[model samples]
Structures are given as C-alpha cells and as structure tokens.
Target chain A: MLEAPAVAALTILILALFVGVEVISKVPPLLHTPLMSGSNAISGITVVGAILAAGSEHDAVAQWLGFAAVVFATVNVVGGFLVTNRMLAMFKKNPKSDA
Target chain B: MSSTDLIQFSYLVAAVLFILGLRNLSSPKTAALGNQMAAVGMLIAIVATLMVQGVVDYTLIVAGIVVGGLIGGVTALRIKMTDMPQMVALLNGFGGAASVLVAGAEVSSRITAGDVPTGIIPGAIVASVLIGGVTLTGSLIAFAKLQELMRGAPIQYPAQQYINALLALGTVAACFFLGMAPLDPQLFGLLVGLALLLGILLVIPIGGADMPVVIALLNSYSGLAACATGFVLDNSALVISGSLVGASGLILTKIMCDAMNRSLANVLFGAFGAVDASAAAGGEGVDQGTATAYTPIDAAVIFSNARSVIVVPGYGMAVAQAQHAVRELTDTLADNGIEVNFAIHPVAGRMPGHMNVLLAEADVPYERLVEMDEINPQFPETDVALVLGANDVVNPAAREDESSPIYGMPVLEVDRAQHVFVIKRSMNPGFAGIQNPLFFKDNTMMIFGDAKKVVIELNDAVKNY
Candidate 1:
C-alpha cells in the first residue's frame, strides 16, 4: 500500500510480529521471568537507530542528542542482558525428578 | 557486495538470531542459550550500524556506551532478586527514553539544516516521541510503586476518566497538527509535555497489585516506540526486532490479565484499589468461623505424619525474605519421606512468576515448582498444605463467591488438601483487599507470625521430630 522502500520494511515488521506472538505464547510459566526480561532486552534494538543518529554528520547540537540517546540505549542493552543472565543462571532442574 | 548490502545482510541474520533466541527461551533447558543468542544479535546490529556511511565520530559514542555500560552492569549485578520487577521497569524506561532522544535529535537537526521532514517521516517522528514519552514516564511510575517510593494504592478522584479522555484527545489532535505543519517548536514542546503527563496519569490510577499488567503494557509501548523510530529512519532491523518485542509484551500483558480474570481496559482503568470500606474500618476482615492458632510444634506434627505436603507461597513470603527458610522445610519434609512440592499460582507475587524467581534464588528445583493447573488435582490427594504469607490465592471465594470482586480469578486450591496451615501476620485481607474464607475453613489452622521466623520454627520442629 506504500512506496517500494517502505513496503519491504513494513512487510518485515508484520512477519516479525507474527513470529513473536507464535514463539512467545509457547513459553511456560517456569520461565515467565526470563521470557519477559529477555524480550524486554531485545526491544533495546533501538540502539541501532540511536547509534545512527549519534554518528550522523549533523551539527554539534544534533550529535549531543545522539550522545544522550546512546547512553540510554546502552543502559537498556547492557542491564537487560546481564539481568536476564543472572535470572537464567538460577533456574535449576532436579536430575532425579521426572517433572 | 557493497558495504550497504553488507549491513542489510547482517541485519537480516541478526533478525533470524533474535527469532531463534526467543524460540529457545520456551524451555528451561535452553533458556540461557536463548539469552546469549539475543545478546549476540544485539551486538551484530550495533556493529553493522557503526559501518554506515555517515558514522565517522567515535569519541562521543564510545564515551556514552562506557558510562552507560558501567551504570547498567553494576545495577543489574547488585540488585537483589526480589527487586527484579523494579529493575526491569527502570531498564524499560531507559529504552523508551533512548528512542525519544534519538528521534528528537534527528528531527531537530534536520530542522536546523532547513530541511523539514515531509511525507510519512513527520508522522513517524510524532509516533516515536509520543509512544516513547509515555513509555518513559509510565515505566518510572511503575518502578516507583514497585520500589515503594510511591504509595501502592490507586490514587483516583472525581472525573478521572473524563480528564484522561480529554488529555488523550488533545494529544492526538496535537500529533495530527504536527504531522501537517512540522515547524511549530512550541506545539512540539506542548506535545512532549502532554505525552509525559499522560504517562503518569495513566499509571497513577492503577494500584500496585496490577503493576505487573501496567509494566507489561509499558514494555509493549517501549517496543512500539522503537518501531516508530525505525520507521522514522527506515531501518528494517529496528522495526523487525522492535515489533517482535511489542508482540511479546502484549502477549504477556494478556496472559497476566487473564490470570487475574480482568480485561486489558479494566486493568488500565478499573482502579481495583477501593477496598471494602467496612472491612477497612473494622481493622480486620470478618473472621466468620474460628481460626484456631497453631504453634510451630503443631505444624511439625502434621508434617511428620503426612505423606505429601504442598507449599503455597505469596507476596508475603517475598516481603519476609522467607524463601530460603521455606526451602529448609522442603528439605526436612523430603528427608522424612514426605512428597514435597510447591504450588505456584500464575499471579501469586507482585509480578507473574515472581514467586518462582525468589524460590529459584533459594535453590528450589525447577521440577518441584508446579503451576496451578497441574497441581490443583494433586491438592485433593495431598495430606497437608503449608501456606506461607499467601491469602487470596487459596480463597474459595474466587470460585464460590459470585459477588466478590476477585470472583473467577484462578487461585491455588490449597483448601482442597486434607489439612491446611496458613502462616500470616494477622487476619487482614490480601493485597486484592478481599476476605479469604479459606482461612476460616474447618480443616484450616492459622499460624500467625513473621513468615521467615515461622518457617524457621517449623523447619526446626520438623528436623527434631
């Protein structure tokens, strides 16, 4: 329904949404914390956009905005991944129990 | 291939990794591997972005990442497991803020260069800012509530809904105007203010008991904010990954709402905060039947004699930091040949799976933590049910009391066990502010005290027996 360039990206977004819903709904309660935390981390993909903004050949004022964006995105990326790992590390299965 | 083609190809691979990563997170066995794969995907996306044509300055980028990395890394490592909800809320806020700042910078710079955005770019920028702004402040409010910096009760007033509706309409109108005229800095500033204020007002009316749903919804907003920023920049990687997270958070929000037997709209605006005024004034719920107080010694007697015992824990266990103490009882009961398993309701603690995180931190095996649906049938065959700091989850009112506010919410049927011992501080209603008839049942005994102290006493008694 749009231009050639926007169409490909929009199509990707639509397919990814379906993939996300299908895959995430299968996660059991056993890993709900991890699932939520992990997906939250993936949303930090905005780091790509932030990085592009920061490094653009714009004026100093614009570059500073990119700088601020980088810091916030970095926090989400770093904190989210580490916290998910710590929680995942705690999940243990009993070798003897069938469940 | 050209460098442009290389970046595109890398993003495609990164997207695939993200999908596979989430797929792997479905099981306990591969969950950690799933996390690592997503991390790798993030790294690839970042590296490929750095290879873009206009990205020449490294000093500011490196400095920001270093500073942010230190702060994010230290906090993630230092925060207690009990504080995970707040931690997630705070990080989600940062994600939103980053999208806002990034999009704001691009638009401001383009304006400065006398090249105001036309076509869909203006709409995309407005969406990114509006959604990101709400996600930012909304997440902070959620963090404040979970962190106890703000009151956990629902703060409501007359015409709250009308005010929210008006503000929402005004914001939408301003956004539409911005898309049409793109140069009114004053209007842009007004839009930003309205977005932030709306976020706060949206979350303030919801009580702490529903913060999980609010946080899940805010998490979705964060992802959607990023997706809009992707449209602003025409980046497929950001759009793909962001929408994936958006869909995931929406699914979680829906699951949490269903567990509480509430709708998404109800959770956002229901103000489920007004507790029964009469019960609050009386200083305690109506203790219809007698609740015979049982000592730890009596609890131990049941444990030693019973063949199987189910432990039902709630937010009270988290508050008292009693997971480790409860684990001791689990070990003691198992030593005596009692089949010990934990019954976990879907919404037992402050957040979904909150109880499981705390129990896992205390070395509770994954196999022993059973979800409600699977363990409900087992409760009827169990010899005893040990309830710690949990009230509403075991309440029969959910299934039996049609008039109750929490009717039909799935709860752990702890009352079905042959004998039930509930450890609580008093006869107060649960966080949902409802009276639990399960405590007054003929087979139930109230063992009142701090959860940790009571659990320790029960462990010692069982060990000595």
Candidate 2:
C-alpha cells in the first residue's frame, strides 16, 4: 500500500505534468531552442537530492556516489541556464515592427 | 517557523518561479528575464538544501559545486552557438547521470546501514537507475554523432533489430532482479551496465536527420530520471520540476516528429537515414538534368529588379558559419527597397528552432524570422528565394515524387517563387540522399560556392547595383 506522503508526491507529479503541458503549449517556433534549454536547466532539480545524499553521514562508497552526483547536477544547472541566457541575449526586436 | 518549514516554503517558491519562468519564455522579449528567474529559483533551492537538518559536510558540498560550476560555466561561455546541440546533449546527460548516482548512493547508504530497501524505495531505485543510465549514454552518442566524432548516418548491422531486442529484454530482466534484491550491488551493477548498452543500441540506429527527435526524447528521459530520484528521496520539488521538464521535452519531440511527418515510434525505430545505402544504390546516377549555374552579379540583377525575397537556410548555414553574411545580405536587400524574410522549417538544422537562433545570433531582428506556415503563403507572391546550403527541406520532390524517401514530409515551397537562387558547395544530394528536382527547374539558378562567400558576393553585387 502507498503511504500518505508517497500518494501526495504522485498527485503532485501528475498535476505538474499537465501544468507543464499547459504552460508551455504556446511557445513559438522561434523560441523552441531556448524553451528546451531553459526547461532543461530546471530538470537539474536533482541537485537537491544530490546535496542531501552528499552532505549526510553515509558510508564511504555512498558518500563518493553522492559527491559525483552533486558535481554532475550542478553542471546541468549552471551550464543549462548560462547557455539559455546566451541564446536569448541575441534576440533583438525588429525595428520595423515598431511601426 | 522551523527550518524544515522554511525549506519547504523555499521549494514551493522555486516551483512557482519555474512555472512562471517557462510561461514567460515563449516570447522573445521576456525570455532573458525568464531565464534569470529560473536561475534564481535554482539558487534558492540549492541554498535551502544546504541548510537542511542532516546536511553537515559543507566542505564536500562546496568543493563539488566549485568543480562542476567551473567546467559547466566555462563551456557555456566559450562554446560557439553553432555547437549548441552538442552542448545541450552533453549537459542533459550530466543531469541523468547525477540522478543515477544519487539513486546509487541512496541504495548504498540503506545497505550500509544494514537494512534492505523495501516497498516503494526499491521500485523508485529501479526507475531512476534504469532511465538515468539510458539517458547518460544515449546523450553521449548524440553528442558524438552531432560533433562528427562518429558516423552521422544510421550505423546498422546485420540482425541489428534482433540483437537490440535481446538487449532490451536482458535489461528488463536485470531490472526485475535488482528490484527483487535491492541490496544486491552486483545485480545493480549489471542493471547499470545493461542500461548503458541499451542506450547506445537505441541511439545508433537513428540517423543524423532525426537528431531533433532524439535529443528531445533524451531530454525527456533525464527529467523522468530526476522524478524517479525524487521518489527515492521522498522530495516533492524534484518530482514537480522533473515532471515539467519531462512534459516539455515530450512536447518538443512530438512537434519535431510531426514536422517530419513521422510518428514517434517511427522516429525512434525507423532508422531514418540509411543514407549511405540509398546513396550507393542511386545517389550518383540520378540524372535530374543539368542545373543552370549563375554568378552573384546575375543574382544581384534579379534581386535589384525584384521586390521581395525569402531566405531558406538549413544545416549548411551553420556549417558555413554564414548567418552573419546572410544578415548582411538581408540589410543590402532592405536598402535596395527589397523585402527579405527568412522561412524557417521546424526540423531545419540539428535542432528545433535552430535557424532562428543562428539568425538571431547575427543580430537579425526576430520579426524577420518567419515560421514555415506563415511564410509558405507569401512565397507564391515573393520575387526571389535564395536557398543557402539547404537541401531536403526545400526539395520539390517531397511534394512531387511519391517514390522519394522524404516524400509527404512538409517542405518549404520555394519552387513556387517567381525566381529561385540556390547556393550549394556541390551537386551531391541532401542528408536523405534524395535528388532535388527544384535545382533543375526552369525558374531556378544554382550558385556554386561556399554559402558565406557567395552571400558576401551577393551583398557586394547588390551594393554596386
């Protein structure tokens, strides 16, 4: 049987999936790369789990695994955000559109 | 409020910011701010995570962050925009690998504490490890293919499907055993190895042309892997954000497949390119007739007399590094009272929206970049269509030749334009190995040269005119 917390987590995940669909449904073709890379940065949420695993007093092997995870997750977050920002910075408005 | 309560609130705030950030990212103007908002959300979450009750090793945590941050940040800053697909694939792999390691550490700690993982923990471990392993290796293969480190076409062997099916079954079997005996490290290792192998097998059969779908699908897997890690750790922030990323990647995958007029199953298993084999059969012998070659002066003459032009760019633009030259041409034509708009196909270049990003990098205004649907109607009324290093997307055969491999896939209808000038390095067919009849058509003129060089000459000619 699923515990109360597990049940709640599942509900949140299902709800979030639909919300994700609804929120990003209208992104134009021009922004697909940024939308992809931006949402990709968000998936680096694994860093939260990685930090917990790394900082806790686990066995040596477990500690090493968590340490590696921290490094990898941080890369995903930092790289993803910077690249998305870099791409977005290049998009200037069309001067003619002002008229 | 207590520290645990504060941490939960921070996670809630992070999730809300992520949602708002993605919502604002659809438009070009607010996209930079949206990215910054998400970055801030990550900072808040990481800070709150550091302050949790049992989290004590500040030294190890800080060291890991520093090392990872340096590598990731430097690569992000220095890598060219043209190599973006490879960079995205590599970073996505890191996320998946982190989830796998986190899951491994969780199970190892449980075993080290002398208790077997039972109930939902075992299943969560299975899901996280399996998906994460697949994403890690799969993305590396995508990186290799895109960077030209490996063969870009689908690498197929005899009985490839049969062997892959067997490998999939073996992975499932290993997963089932690991689930049953959660404390068994040997079984876990076997599962991990099998997953890595399965990832390679899955990606190798896919061709270079279908990379958008491959990258999108792998992006989705990394998110699901993170969601599974959330279940292993009983964390909600990971669950919600993971699901959102999963959904976004899936939607992009669907859109890409639709653009190619192929199903998701087909993209995954169709072994689309097989270009070498098809090319060997008829690649060199297709007598589509002699294409009329022209110079930039002639092109400039046609363009000066014309009123409007549309640019169709493909992978060649990225290869030639010609986005800036194309922008110069756009400016040259605009000064001559000629309207120029870029028609972007969804599956153009290595990724979705890739052409727009390339053009935007050249400081071309976002308004001049038009979607395939919006610009298709205007092509019939336009004067000249200058195609640069693009092939399959503009091939008239996609609409006319039922026997063509790329038939029925939606292509930019540039043939309908009054005059078309195509710049290509050679007469070789496109990535799909399909000969394009558009080049030999009556209204078309082929300019043989590098895309960047040719565009510069066209700009010079237009200036002299």
Candidate 3:
C-alpha cells in the first residue's frame, strides 16, 4: 500500500540518521556535558511531531497517544532546562559567603 | 501556510534553535540562557504542531500535562546536586524507552494490518528496538553505579569480552531477520532482548574510571534510536532534532575517548579498568614508607609564610559539600595578598567537570582556576599546594613510570609544589584503588580530618594568623 514518495522520504530520513551518527562520532569529549544539555533541547521536536500526527486525526486513540507524547516531551524539555539551570547556578560564585 | 510548508517551517525553526543552543553552550556564561532558548523553541514547535493538526479531546492532553509537570517539577526541586549524574542517566534511559515504545507500536500496527514491507518501517523498527534496548539497560546500570547501589568496579568473568561480542552478533542477526520479515513478533522480542543484554555486557566490563565516557556513548545511542523512531513515524521535525542530538552526543563520546587515550574499539571491547592482578600490582611508588607523624601548623604560619598557594580539589569536595569552605580559604589568602590558584587535571574526579562545578558553586573566580598544563609549571614556584581530598589526580606515578596502570595519563603536578598539605580522613587510596606516592613525600603533610571540617579549620587558622 506504500507509494514511491513515501519510500523515498523514509530512505532520506534513515540516511540522515546515519549521517548524524557519523557526525557525533567525530565530536570531542570535553564538550560532552554541554552537548548533551543542548541536544536535549533538540529532542523536544518529538513532542511537536507527535502532537501534529495525533491531533490531525479525529480518533480518541490518536488524540490520547499524541497527548502522551506531548507530556513526555514537555517533561524532557522542562526537566532539561531545570537541571541545566541548577548546574549553571553551581558556577555562580556566591559573593557574600566566605566559607 | 500549506500543511507541508508548515511542517517544513517547523523543522527549520527547530534546527535553528538547535544550532543556537549548541553555540550558546560553548561558554559557561551563556549555557543557561541557551538552555532556556532551546526549551522555549521546543515549546513553540510543539504548540505549532498541535495547532496545525487540530485534534479533538484536549482533556487527556491537559491531564497528561498536569501529571508530567507535577512529577518533573517535584523531582527537579528535590534531587540533590550530588545525584545529578544519576538523574541524567535516568533521563537518558527514559528517552530511549520512549523511542522503543513508539517504534514498537508502529511496527505492531503495521504487522497486524498485514503490511510486511521490506524497506523503511522494518529498518526503523530494527534500529529503534536495538538502540533503545541497549541504551535503556546500559543507562540503568550506570545510574545504579552512580547512585552507589551497585559496585563501581567492572564486573568481570572469564571470556566476558567474547560473550559480549556474541550478544552483539546475535543482535545484528536479529536485526537482519526483522528486516527480512517484519511481521515476526518473536524476532522483534528476541532482538530487543539481545540488545538489552548487549548493553549490560557492554557496561559490565567498563570500570568506573571510564564511566563518564560510557555515559556519553550511551547518550549518543539513545539519540540515534530516537532518530530512527522519527523515520518510522515519518516526522520531519523529529528526524531533524533527533539527528542533531545523535550527532552531537557521538562526537562528545569520541572526544572523551581521546582524552583517555582510548579508541572506540577499546572502549567497547578492551574491558577498560578490568585489570588483571598483574595490572593492579602496586607500582614502585606504593613501596615507599608511610609516615604517621606531622607537626600541625597554625593558620597564620600557612598564610603569612607561604608566598603562593595552590588548591587541589577532588571527589570528596563534591561529596562533603566543602567547595564553599575551600573558596573561603582562597578568599582569605587573597585578602592577605597571597597568590592562590586552583589546579584541575583532565580526570580530576568522578567526571570530567566535577571540580569545576564544585568550585564554580563556591563562586571561585574563573580566572583563578587553572588547567593542568598551565598549572603544572607553577607548582615548583608554589610555596604551598593544599590538596582537598584529591588522590589519583595528584599521583606522580602517572607521569614517571611506564608500568603504572595510569601511565601516559596526564595528572596535576601538585607534588612538585614546595610544600604539599593534604587534607584527608585517612591514608586511603582513591577510587582507582592505588596509593598515591605524593602523600608520603618528604615535603608532603597529611592533615587527617573531614574535608569540610579541615577546610573550615584552615580558614580559621588563616584568619587567626
């Protein structure tokens, strides 16, 4: 039931994923912490995609699934920011405290 | 906008946000704001997708939002800083699990409808299932070790590496079979199991010293799995974002490997830190005599007499919550016009940036912190190097002897300082289970006590002096 365009799109996506892997393999380790915290933000795209796919349909199941993806993605996005904030806070030298 | 155009635009926006986030993260000052920008961009993208799709039944979505938000907010507020690494591991695992579930559901739905296409879905399913399984199990083990619920040492057995290799091979075979016949639920389950086992085996033989690298590598796997899931769903935004994460994580992992002088193959198969008895044998440094006596000096003598002071912090500084105390001591010295600098080696503590985080928390000025290369030359000129619970990073054997387990590994040259004052509870070896020769050196003095207490005492001594 699949068409050529759909197949081609999927192939391109797969190739992109492979390329991404290759790119990651090349980055240095000193940047791992910052990279992870940054990439976490990018992963939020899943939430958006899930919402679109699920919301476009009229079915209850699709709506609920999309809702779940949104929730998960939101948690990931928000938690990432919170943790990053806390981490950055640690670096903010308290000026008043001597000990 | 047309539906396709809207989706394409969203992808572009998400990609731009990712690039900006990465750029912002390059420096400590902008990292937090960068995270915020990325988060807001993600929110915008998510809302846009939902609006464009126009779904009914926002009730469940609202409920999910409430529940997820509550959990996330509470966990963020409650989790201690010391447990940050474990928290990261758990989060990474969750991401992997979500991708696996998404891929599994898609594959099952396709199979049940009698769609056994030999191309995209099958490949995506295999990739997602495999990578997810590995990431989930590996991350759990890492979390356990970081939490101290499991041993940090590599759990080894006879032919452990071979068994791990076999598991990897089995996983590949399962992936191939799944690709050939996508409808086989049994093969899918087997593949997942094999991948899970491979993940465990992969982590089991990796010692604690290499955990930061392992965690980074596992994170990359999780990102790749998510990207594969995006393909299965045909979501362009997911594909773009997931690919960015996957690429960045892998690069970071490779960098960490290079810092340790390790190859990816060695990291994956060499069973690093699972040394044999011969490898663990005490080097010539350990044969040195242990002294039980030292004349305790007053604080005034330490500050007034010393021309220059170096501060060495370790994992204990992170544990005892003594970074603030250490910072205070530095400030007190700076008040006396005594020069002070912090020495950070490449692998100073549990993770790469452990001390950096600790000191930064204490509000230690960035300019005062020095890297190993910059600080090594100043050690001889340093009148005193105050080691605050550091062990392995200051060990001189890493540079002097070829037979040492950590040979060729760069370490902070604190021992080269004119006077070394080590504040520790006892003469215990570090996580590497190797005694430090610097502890017993003629010029070295061990001040036995809790790090936090000792630092505070040192502060008091400097103040009274």
**Tens-place lDDT digits, model 1, residues B1-465:** 999999999998898999999999888888889899999998999999899998988888888889888998999899898888898888778888988888878777777888877666788889988999999999999999989999888888899999999999999999998888665677777888888999999999888888778878888888899898988888998898889889988988998899889999998888886665874555343556777898999988878789999999988898899999988889888888889899998877777678889998888888889998899999899999989988777888899978778899998888889999999999877767887888889999999999999999999998987
TM-score of candidate 3 to 2 decimals: 0.87
Computed on C-alpha atoms, the DockQ of candidate 2 is 0.74
> Which candidate number maximizes lDDT?
2
DockQ of 1: 0.68
Task: Tell me how each candidate scores on DockQ against the true complex.
Answer: 0.68, 0.74, 0.34
Candidate 3 error regions (>4 Å): A1-35, A49-72, A89-99, B52-60, B279-286, B291-300
Assess the local accuracy of residue A73 in candidate 2 as a C-alpha lDDT between 0 and 100: 91
Please provide, for model 3 over B1-465, each residue's C-alpha lDDT reduced to its tens digit, 9 standing for 90 to 100.
787687668666765675566666666566667677777667667666555645444566566567656766677668766566676677677667667656655555455556665546678778878887888899898888887789888788988767776777777788999888876878877887887887787787777767777777777776777777777776666776776677666666765666555687876666665545664564533567774444334434756788799998877777788888888878888888888888876555555455666676567866566777778999989999988877867888888867666666678888888888888878756666665778778888888888898888778877876
Model 2 clashing-pair count: 0
The model with the greatest TM-score is: 2
List the pairs of residues colliding in candidate 2.
none
Every model's TM-score: 0.96, 0.97, 0.87
- Summed backbone clashes in each candidate are 0, 0, 11
RMSD of each: 2.0, 1.7, 3.9
